[model samples]
Target: MPTTSPFALLLDVDGPIASPVTRDVAPEIIGLLLDLAVSGIPVVFNTGRSDDFIKQQVMAPMIAAGMPSTLKIHAICEKGATWFTFDSTGAGEVQVDHDLAVPGHYSDEIRELVASSFASHMFFDETKRAMVSVEQNIDADNTEYRRVQADFDAAALEAMIRLGLGVERLEVSLPDANSGIEYRVDPTIISTDIESVALGKDLGARRALNLLSADGIVPGAWFTVGDSRTDYAMADWLAAHGHEVSHVDVRPGDGIPAGKPYPVLTAGDLGLGDEVIHDHAGLAFLRHWRAQLDPGMVINSTELSEASV
Candidate 1:
C-alpha cells in the first residue's frame, strides 16, 4: 500500500539477521523484515548459509507470519554457489552451480574431520548443496568453537594438499609463491565454509541485482548489512558497478575496513552502545531504515542526521 521503498536490502544471514549463538531470528526482527517487505522493498538475502537453512530459519517463519505472495524475495546462498526465490506460497526452484562446488571428497574428508576432532564445538552441515560448511553447534560456546576451529581447518587443509588440490584459507595474510590456489577454507564467527575461491559475496550481490531486474524492479539505491569483513564484498561490488549504496557492519568489534569508497556505518553511529552488536545492531539498523522510509515515525532523542556517515 505504501510506496515502494527507495532502497533495496542485500543481507547476510548468520550474524546480521539470525543470531550466531542461537542460530535463529528473533520475532521482532522477523516482524520488521515483514514490514519492510510489505512496504515493497526488495529484500534479498546473500550469505554463505545453504538454501535449506534459509528456507527453514527465514522463509518458514516469514510464511507463517502471513507474508504476501506479491513480495518476491530472493536468497543467494552458499556464498553464491546456490540460490532460490520464495513468496507467500512457498519456496521456488533452486539453482546451483555444480562446477563451483568443491570436490565431493573434500566435503567427505571435512565431515570426518569435524566428527572426529571437533564434534563438541562444531558439526558438518549436511544441508549445504554446494559448498562444505561446518557450523558451530547451537549449544556450543563461542570461545570453544574458536579454539578448535583452527585445528579443524588445518586438518582439512592438509587433506586437500594430500589430495594434490591447490587450496588456501580465507583471510590469510600471505599467498604462497605458487599462485594456483583454487579454494579457501573460510572460517567465520560460528562456522567454517570451505568453498571455491570464485564464490563470494560480490557474486551474490550481482546475482541479487539480476534477480531484482528479472522481477522488473529497480531500487533507487541499496543497503547491504553484514557482521564480518567478507560481507564488504557486496557493497564493494555495488559501489564499483556505479550503484548508490551504503554498508552497515553489524559487528565491528573485529575491525572495520579502511578507505572504503561508500559510507560504512553501524548502530553505534545511531546512538547504540558497543555491547549491542550482531543481531541487536542489525535490528537497530532495520528500525533506522524503517523510520526513514515512513516519515510518520519519530525517534525519542537520537538524530538520524548524526547517524548517516
Candidate 2:
C-alpha cells in the first residue's frame, strides 16, 4: 500500500483519459491504466458519457491492450442511468434505468432539433440510452461552437417547456445544482447534456462505490479525477459515506472550488503550468499514483510528458 491503507481510483473519462481534441484514448494511458489494475488498484470509470461511447473509446482499447478477466472494472455511464462491467471478455450486459430517460418523443424532438438547426456545430448522440446529448462536432471550431452553444441550450429549454417537461438548466460555470429535479440542461465544453434529475455524478459515485463494495473491493482511500466542477460530487459522495477521499481537478483553470470537506488537488500543484491542463494533467497524476504504488519506480517523466502532448 502507498499509505496506511490501499487506495482505489474513481475516474471521469473525457478530459482525463481521452484527448478532448481527438476524442480518443492514447496508448500510454491504456498501458498505465492496466498497470494500476494489475497492481491491485480498483479502478472505476464514472462519467456522463454513454455506455456505447465508453465501450468503443475506452473499453475496447483496454481489452485489446490486454485487460485481464480477473480484473473487474465498472463503468457508470450516462451519469447514473446506465452501467455495465467489463474485463478481458469485453463489456458485460448493460443495465439501464429506462424510467429515468427523458420521453422518447422529447429525445426525438431534440434529435430533429439538432439536425435541422445545429448540424454544423453539433450532432445528436445516437448511443445515449437515457440522457439526450448533443456534442460539438470534432471538426467545428471551438470558438464558434462555444458561441452557438448557448443558443442551442436556450432552444432546448424552450423545447422542454413546449413538451411540458419540468426543467432546469445547469452550467459547469455554476457549481451547485439540484440533481433531483425532473429534468435539466447541462452544458459542458464540448457538449450539452439533458438528463433526469436522478442522474448525476453523485449518483454515479454511489453506484460505483456500492458495486465495488459488493465485490469486497472497498479501499480506505479513493482518488476521484475529473476536469469539471460536477466531478466533485464523486469525492463528496465518498466522504459522506465515511470514506477518505480526495479529488484531483485536471483542469483547474476554471478555479478550484471552495470549502470542500476533503482536499482538492490540481495538476498545477505539481508545477505543470496552466498550458498543461486536461489530459496532460491527468497523465501526470496517473504517473504519480503508479510511482506511489511501486515506490521509486522510475517513469521517464520527460518522455511521458512529450508523448502525452
Q: Across residues 1-309, which tens digit of lDDT does each residue of candidate 2 receive? A: 122228888899999888888889888788889999888888899999999989899889999998887877899999889999998988899999999998999999999999999999999999999999999999999889999999999898888777666788864222223332478899999999999878889999899878887776768799999999989999999899899999999888788889999999986666556677777888888887888888678666565466446
* Per-candidate clash tally: 0, 0
77-150 per-residue lDDT for model 1 (tens digits):
99999999998888999999999998898788888888888898889899999899898888888897888888
Pairs with steric clashes in candidate 2:
none
TM-score of each: 0.93, 0.93
As for candidate 1, its clashing pairs are: none
Candidate 2 least-lDDT 10 residues: 171-180
Show where candidate 2 strays beyond 4 Å. 1-5, 171-181, 299-308
